[model samples]
Target: MAGFGWATHSAHKHSANRHHLRTKARMDAGFRQMNGNLERKGSLTSSYLEEPLNKTGVVSCIFSLKQEVGALVKALRLFEEKGINLTHIESRPSRNNKEEYEFFISVDQLSSKALDEVVDGLRTQISGQVHELSRNKQKDTVPWFPNDIQDLDRFANQILSYGSELDADHPGFTDPVYRARRKEFADIAYNYRHAQVIPRVEYTAEEKYCGYREDNIPQLEDISHYLQTCTGFRLRPVAGLLSSRDFLAGLAFRVFHSTQYIRHSSKPMYTPEPDICHELLGHVPLFADPSFAQFSQEIGLASLGAPDEFIEKLATVYWFTVEFGLCKEGNEVKAYGAGLLSSFGELQYCLTDKPKLLPFEPEKTCQQKYPITEFQPVYYVAESFEDAKEKVRKFASIIPRPFSVRYNAYTQRIEVLDNTQQLKNLADSISGEISILCTALRKME
Candidate 1:
């Protein structure tokens, strides 16, 4: 599905209230002294010093201080002396040592050299061990990936809520009643649990103007149960649009993160983002079909550890296939994509010759671009859901991950077949299942 808005939102920011007692001259002297010492040690490189101040990114580091009365203050003073901005800070008792306290600090706008200096200072002066927390593409630094279905809870607050704080161009931006209604929906999603039944929405008549039946706003749990039975796909409420990585990761576990809020009542047929109408009326039916479900999961699985460029490609493929796709039914082309199905006007326009229609090939579809603020000018037509699934499976084989992963439903975990022992375990498990099937067949014979 197209994202609400493709803006990156960082939940962490520098607090304005944080104060430093060190003067500018003192901090500058400290910075120069630290740089000179590091240079003498061959640790601080000249290239790092040439980088612009604005080029810095957020970096988190953890260190533990001795139980001395002023140990925490002394460690913090190291940052103040170097003029580094501490965006966030937290403290907890060290698990390994009761007398020590572990401190986690997120530093904002610090260059690589500056961070290294801070780490060195912390280790040499106040703390013996200092480690930098990282989220990068390296094997050792790759961000955490969800292994089980319940792991999705961590991403609940990780999304950008376009509905809660409406953009100026959004239809409900100035409507007090509409904003309040949206907040009500946002609260439901915020408090939702993994396995709990979804609360039924009593959508107003205006909210039902999207051409769905008056009583068609079924509870998410009902749709989730139906999808589970048909294709093992289930639904979970989301505050708003998740990052492409998080959204596709959910699909890997056969879970769909759906928005609980509906579009502004003033513009029922047109919405700037995905709402309950788009999710249920447009997307739910296809998810119930086994072939399409498999097709969807193929895209999701390929996204694991994928590069940013490839993620954009995968998202585009999702946009063309799952969101605004069309398929042949007998001799007529029918609307199957959620975007087209949800919007009454777009639904009618896409089936007509108003938009360009092309065969749904993953290679071409991934490269095709579409506008988000307006109706899609191009749509991909699939021969059938089964055909789409087979093509996607072939396409997924080429994704550049060094290891392959499979979901173990029995254990509710993703098993990475990167080691010999893991492969052997998987092989033995499969062999036992095959043996059981053989016994049943022999008994029947």
Candidate 2:
């Protein structure tokens, strides 16, 4: 994953793990803020210190629904008429959900002032509502069409997820099967693999203090007791694209991110800063389910852009809705964020009186306010995964084929058929010419 370059707002610790923060609206800054300039830490952690972002991109704006929706609708209509291509749409709640909401929108190309004017014109502020501020803002242009064959090549390159239990004996090693699988997949990336987090083991040599005082990676059996008794949420990060938006797009398509790292035995609720363990073990299982995976990909493609402010705001939406989203699951508040996967804190926090849980509303979520230092004060509850997808669809209604699995599958198959048909024609033509030559040669003979 490429590191996100963030422009910092202040030099302060946003979270316990320096990795869990962000700065400013769009500019990702350095690990340590200094001098008027928010130094580029050259890493995602130092940059988006307090601000949560999708993948590693900077997020600048969580636009107010009242302030930007009109503009957004206007922009979408204009895009339709002018053949503009839009990519992403998401919403997050304002930290204070009493009035406004935040909306995050992105397209292949950045939006311009003219476009913003159209969007702003369409924006309608509610009575006594404040428009959200913009930060690290960027407007991208519609992406040029990709070379189909090149894109095909990119798609054809497959990375399969594979791993095994740690060997334990290797000290910093995984199981022998895990070792073997890792070796097999060492060269390939952009893969979807299935791995479990073994809590009773050491993750890396850097942290040699194994919780169990044992010499092994955690296993399913070892953690079964904990899982049976597990409560709350666990956060796992699926790394998004850095530098190349397409890499992030690809992840948005289908590939889920994960790691082989396991947590120490000491912490039953182990949360690594950012690792395959947290990402894969905690998150990919959701991807395995078609509903979650489709929702993820659909939402991913539905929400692509470059403005840092927009990215930051979208991250919050993803965190609150997809990552840490709660839903009415059989008379209970269930989790969706990987962060809540195994964390006791999440289970309690999400259900506690502190959070203002609202029915998932695109407009409200977009205007919602949140802070990096505190546990979320509000979480938008979706009716279902479909409700989440609907939120994306409703936002990007003007954009056609916003993550239609049937369509993606159909197109994917069509491309295959098209390639196959071309080869078949070549083969037949070659054979026909060969036969003609043979006939001519025979006559001469």
Candidate 3:
């Protein structure tokens, strides 16, 4: 929900307001001309113009630069000479070569002919395997994450088939309700014990992980149990119809996909808002992993009393990592983020040779922009769970908050480290409520 500041790569665009205005004027005129052509020559229009131009007004280019020191400078010079305004440029470790880097660049849009010429030039001067992702624009529509349990069940058979096709193991096979749902999907739940995409747990975390998955279609009670058993986080359900909370008491799963809110009937995969599917499928899976739970709680804890600016940064980090993050498993990149996991279209598209994959760096990850309406144009890939947690810790520490937090798994309380007795006492009061709620929640098991 935070607005991210992107550093422009073009020196001209950074300082020259005149140049920026000129570019805008040219783009507007081009759009107008194209629109007029469509209206005047409706029957005789070219098939090429029939394809909608990218209204995002940006083009992403991924290319490898020669290892030479001057390679980047030469590439920049080419863009400058062509009057191509670049919004962003960053380099990441190439998948194949350690010595070289894959440069991801975003530039202002140009006409099709001009864009084609730029791609040709980059391929000739830069690496031969330059990839320009599909620039085709989708018809604008309201985006949502599926939330309804009943609605999700409508695709149970389809999901089961897809899971079997991928040889995926369904979580929560032990519960009768889960087994019943699995039966509807031809017993896809009992196909395997667990998913290979998740990290392997040692003997210590194994018991708690299994306990978290006791119920396949978890209720608020089940989720509360999972949170306490696995992560020591609490689940606080909302009371009223209209609510202002993004997350309840800094950590609860705020239900956004209920009957009260708007729902998408025609587009099964698309949700106009975050649904229960996004919470259960997208988020809860990672909670089963201990280290990931700690990382997530740290973000939640940091958000408790932080300033709006720092909270925004925390939100950005959460968005990129917890919501849309990918991690490397052996030689493969797998999605663990709820946003990617819940959306079938994006789940497959992300792993394909489509979106740009960059190594997980907290600084860069938080700064990158994402598209919610279409397939993500870029994703940050983590080396491992430990790597992600360490990076998150480093980033969290830099947040300019006045207090520190510590969670007691034994008492199910969050303790605040602060100078003010008033604030400390306030935190203690909340911790007491959490302790009581957690005790009752655990009893549901």
State TM-scores per candidate.
0.66, 0.44, 0.43
lDDT of candidate 3 over 1-445, digit per residue (tens): 0011111111111112111111223312322233322123231111012222456666555666657778888777777777777786766665334456667676665643355656677678765345333244322111111112122121112210111121122233234453333233333222212111111112223222323245333454455466656655433222111111123113422212111111122232343233334455666667767787767656655554343345445656766677678998998888887766666666777789988989989877767655433556888899988898888778878766434555444433344443244355557778999999999999998
Tell me the tens digit of each residue's lDDT in model 1 across 1-445. Answer: 3232220011111111111111223212222233222113322111011111222365555577778888888887888888888887877775435567777666764344576677778877764445224322322222235666676675554554363777787778899988988888888887887888888888777777654565656778888999999999999988766666667778888888888777676655456666666688778888998888888888887776555566667777887888777888899889887766656667777778788989999988888755544556788999988888888877777776555677776665566554455678789999999999999999999
User: Candidate order by lDDT, highest to lowest?
Assistant: 1, 3, 2
C-alpha RMSD in Å of predicted model 3 compared with the true structure: 23.7
Q: Is candidate 1 or candidate 3 better by TM-score?
A: 1
Tell me the RMSD of model 1 versus the true structure. Answer: 13.3
Write the candidate numbers in order of decreasing TM-score.
1, 2, 3
What digit string (tens of lDDT, one per residue) describes model 2 on residues 283-398? 54575556676676565554343234444544445556655678778787788766555344555667888878898876557567665444567888888887788786665443
* lDDT agreement of model 3 with the native: 0.46
- Candidates 2 and 3 compared by lDDT, better number: 3
Ten contiguous residues with the weakest lDDT in model 3: 1-10
- The residue ranges of model 2 lying beyond 4 angstroms of the native Cα positions read 1-140, 143-248, 262-272, 304-313, 398-407, 410-445
Worst 10 residues of 1 by lDDT: 13-22
How much is 50 displaced in model 2, in angstroms?
Answer: 27
Which candidate's lDDT is highest?
Answer: 1
lDDT of each: 0.65, 0.40, 0.46
